[model samples]
Target chain A: MKAIFNKKITFVIIGLLGMVLAVTVSGCKVNEAISSKTGAQLWGENCRRCHNAPDPNTFSPEQWKTVGMHMQTRALITNVERDKIVAFLQQ
Target chain B: MKQYITIITIALLTSTFAKAQTKDTIEVQKIGDKYYVIVDHPKVDTTKQFAPAPAPPPTISKTFDSHFMVVGLATIGFLNTWSVNKVNTPTGVVSTKLPTTNSFGDVAHYEFSPMFLWRHSDNILVEFEPSFSNGSLGVNWADITYFAYPGVILRAGYIVLPFGTYNKRLAAGWICKLPTDPVSITSSPVGSDWGIELEGGQQTGKMKVNYDVALTNGFTLSATDGSIANPDVNAVDNNLGKTVTGRFGWLPALNSGVEIGASGLWGKAGDANTAYKNVSTAMGALDFQWVYAKKPVAINIKAEADMQYVTNASYSNPNPPTVSDTTYTYKNLSYGYYGMFSIRPIVADKFFRNVEFAVRYSSYQSPKGSAFENRQDQISAGVCYWINWRTVFKIGYENLITTNPDNNELAITNLKNTQNILYVQFSVQF
Candidate 1:
């Protein structure tokens, strides 16, 4: 009986992994929205998760570059997101 | 008769001149070793009161708006709480108080912490925070980072470990939702240590993957009795072993609103050449986050679980065992887990839209007979008002329940006395 239970659990885990892989494939086919997000969109989406979105004009171009790096490390943001946000804030 | 009239006129004129001169006159005289002059004049007005203005406010911050500069986040807040509990002792019933969380039950519990970030260049950044709580000065985390590229980063110095979500992403005063930190769940083993880390993220077609790894002078074990000695600060290594810790995250959402993460740490904890030299410790944590935003409302869901296992070893028993057998051993295992849910009405008016409600539940357990033995559960609920983009006013309440089984007797030694607490805090990141 114990062996049967272990086999069932193993099968369930494998099935879940297959589903996750399928979803990944479908999502990529749908759109590259995650990578193509504009700096303004990425800035608002990521900042709003923790606190209110800061004004892009808060820092100068040089300052925003530094802030972009800091936020990437602090918030675990993707490189593309960081670059776009920095570009937007610098503008 | 003519001569007498002339004399009378001259005398009258001379008397008039003398009276006029006496009204305003100067006299010079010598007193002691120096000459002195006196002048008599009509009195001048001298009746005005003196008033002074109050001092200016403290310099809480400075703008690092320049291309290369340093900016700061200043936080100051207070906490208050009370508890009630009834315990039955060996003889009779007793009223007892449990240990307070943070500033709970202490009127003087106050904190003023200043966190700083310096951008040296486009590729180099430095971050550090100083903590001042209840009149003591300490460090939160100080580290420098280098962005090698858009997808890779290299960092060194005393840095926050890539553990659970609490210490890395949300432990800041302005970021936490409640007045008190949730019990039983947090950055496990240790919060941070002197370390070097390498991290990067990449997009594979539709999926985004992020990973971070670190090597540091990790934890130490008690030499006499084999138990974990968490090293949360920068210290010299007691042994030759270096700990390896890291986290990997996956985000499948196009909007970056969902993420699932797994983290782990492992190291040799015993001192070199010690009897417990082979005692190794390992910990792992799983975390999840989801966010929903629409016209009607916004929702946030977060969950995490942490587990630790230490290699078995024998140690001196605390209790007075038989002289011949003074050593004892027990399984060293512990775990903590929590889940949080929060919501806010985004479509409402300005005041209502800024209002958020959050609640969390947590439970944790430790080895049965170890010195760090504990079993605790906690529930915290709170409301937050976003005063601005980075400032907040929060009000929260927490209910803690603890239980230990054995003869159905509540020993109530530790494990945080069971109690209900209320908290209010105002935190700002500026």
Candidate 2:
């Protein structure tokens, strides 16, 4: 019975992996859309996904630059998004 | 006499002009009653190195604009608990009440975890966090990452495992909606470990994909040769085989605010030479998250479930009723899951906008044959007021129930234990 259940789990895992591969392959053919967005739009949408949206005045441009880089690593945001958010915060 | 005087004056003037050309000169400019001194540097035929080092820079740290930052979180809270026990009697069931126990750390207590980060370069970042909770201190995570490209990264050192959403992303005090974690998430945790990981995310047209793969020193058996327990983290690998774990996540479209992820781990979890040496373990998890932030209200929802399977193995009991029955064997399997929801009103009033409410349900189970066989169910609800983006005050209550399998005679195994707790806490990230 355990072996049978393991096989089912294996199939589910393989299915998920197939989906991941499909996304990876499809992403290569289309234009990256996140680059076309405005800094304000990125700032509003991305920050709220995890915690509250931050006040722009909370940090200086220098600090916001670091914060943007940190979020790129922490939240898995793209470099373009980080730069745009930093630019918006600095503005 | 006129000719002689003219010659003598011309010669004297020529001598004075020659004297002024060779010597140093100083000029002072006055602006608003303040004099600025200017010293003219004489033409020279020499050069000098002001900050002389090895001819070429030796280390990368010398030329980069790096930053050393300290960020942390602190929470202080109070908790009150009530417990009840039940026992089997000759004729019927008997109920007993214990004194209400007041504690500090069971639900919420004083906790401080500070992260130290070093931005070594534009592409490399090193981070470590030391945590102090209740009365003990431990290092939460320490790791270094190199962003090799836009969507690929290399990481090493004590890295957080890519199992579930909470431990990697939402375990911070400022982010978690409630005062305590779901009981189910804690029971079957593949938390951070000493490992090397490759992780990254890419926006693929409409769908987004992210993945993390790791190789680590996996769980190990206890040193005391004790039976009936969960595997523990080993700083050093006790066996030749290592654990492999990875998580894959996908979002259907850009700005979807919805993501589904799956994670799996497999490896040997035993010492090199023993009867339990051949024990193998496998684990799998599925997680989902959604966040909606629009006109009238903002809502967040998340869920995660995990299952673990281990090959059957026998263990030496720490204590035996009879010498003949010193070893016991059982099937090893366990599973757990949790679901959480939260909402905040986004209205004109500032006060109401910062107010939020959340609830969670969690359950865990181990089969009858396992040494640590039991079942648990918990429900937690909380209300919070956000002081700022990174600060919050929360009041929460939780009820938990535990049921044990049929047992012979053991001092520790119980029929049932039920507990209810109420707590309030203030948490801030800085």
Candidate 3:
């Protein structure tokens, strides 16, 4: 009985993974164009999807440089884009 | 007689001469720090004037006086600059329902925490986070951190122990899709301690590396059973040797949507007593996080596992071969693991874009040696609505199961083998 229960849980997890993958693939097919917007606008549009948006002026210029570069990798943005975002936050 | 007549004539003449002289415009005037006589009745030119040399612009010598002003200005500059950290407010309510022989419902918990941060400069920051629950107030974590250089930071004061991603990343309600914390962390582990640490992370090549090393007040055994080791959060170190904790991780870049880490803590668990000397405790954990956000779908996955081991424990046995001798050695150990998955189906529709669905599964077991077999498993599923970027409303349903078959006597009547819980929370950070 315990083995059967474990098998059922495994199936449920697999099914959920399949469903998530299907949805993600369909979403990518629908919206193929990459966004070409300002750093501030991109940050608001992207970061807000998962967590709350942080204030731009929360860190200093020096701090923003480091944070922005780190976030670029975390957010999967290009270095140029990270630079623009850092500039916006710094101002 | 001759002198008197002459004096009378001379007085009349003197009066006439004085009046004439006055009409001629003889005048004494002060100019350029000197007195000048001017006769301007077409008899003298007053263009010639005396003037004192202009003093050099007030100058300070290259002595202490000149450098003192420079030092004073610099000191003021340091004091005047400051930064304010983002305010994080996570307040929520949790309710649980037990449907056993003694069926009842209870509002299990309500808590509020406000995070305060003062950034004295780009390199220096101070944080104070206080929590309130059921009219009881407590300090969560308060610390001061200094950024010595890029990828290096030194921190001191009460700090949140860096065990896994849960304590730092998903701790805030607004940052998590579900409103409940994983049972594995809360069941048998330390969350925070008063400590000093060095921590920092940076990208190296295509990977990111982060590390934290700390020394803190260690753990102590439960006074009653000596089985459960508890963190010395609100107390001074009871032993001479301090606890040392550290975590190190290598990630495929933070933006690569994946991160993995390993953390460990070890220290003596006994107080300054000869009998309890050499008693020790050790804890270790592995954690991972993956987030993917794209066109039509967004998914976030997290997992963690923790194991705890305690040295020899002496417990009084209820049933012993020798009735007079009741003390027995028990191997104290426990392990727990949990996984959480959340996804947002970006269906181009306005409503679905702002909604997320998530699920979590957790298991914890502390095998029976003393009293009863304690095994717990929980399943939680929830939905979140993004009011904006920083505010979220979440509701989740949690089903928990436990087994304890030794005795009927329990702390709470409603706490039994099975329980269903409903949790709702509204969180915002700015």
The best candidate by lDDT is 2
Residues B104-124, candidate 1: write the lDDT tens digits.
424333456665777776677
Model 3 chain A: ten consecutive residues of lowest lDDT: A27-36
CAPRI level of candidate 3: incorrect
C-alpha lDDT of candidate 1 relative to the true structure: 0.71
Cα TM-score of candidate 1: 0.76
Error of 3 at B300 (Å): 0.2
Higher-DockQ candidate of 2 and 3: 2
Sorted by TM-score (best first), the order is 2, 1, 3
Poorest stretch of ten by lDDT in candidate 1 chain B: B44-53
Q: Between candidates 1 and 3, which one is better according to DockQ? A: 1
Q: In candidate 2 chain B, what residue range of length 10 has the lowest lDDT sum? A: B45-54
lDDT of 2 by residue, B287-347 (tens): 9989898879899999999888777666665566678877666667788999999999999
DockQ of each two-chain model: 0.20, 0.41, 0.06
Best-first order by DockQ: 2, 1, 3
Please provide TM-scores, in order, for all candidate models, with all chains considered together: 0.76, 0.82, 0.65
| lDDT: the better of candidates 1 and 2 | 2
Ranking by lDDT: 2, 1, 3
Which one is best on TM-score? 2
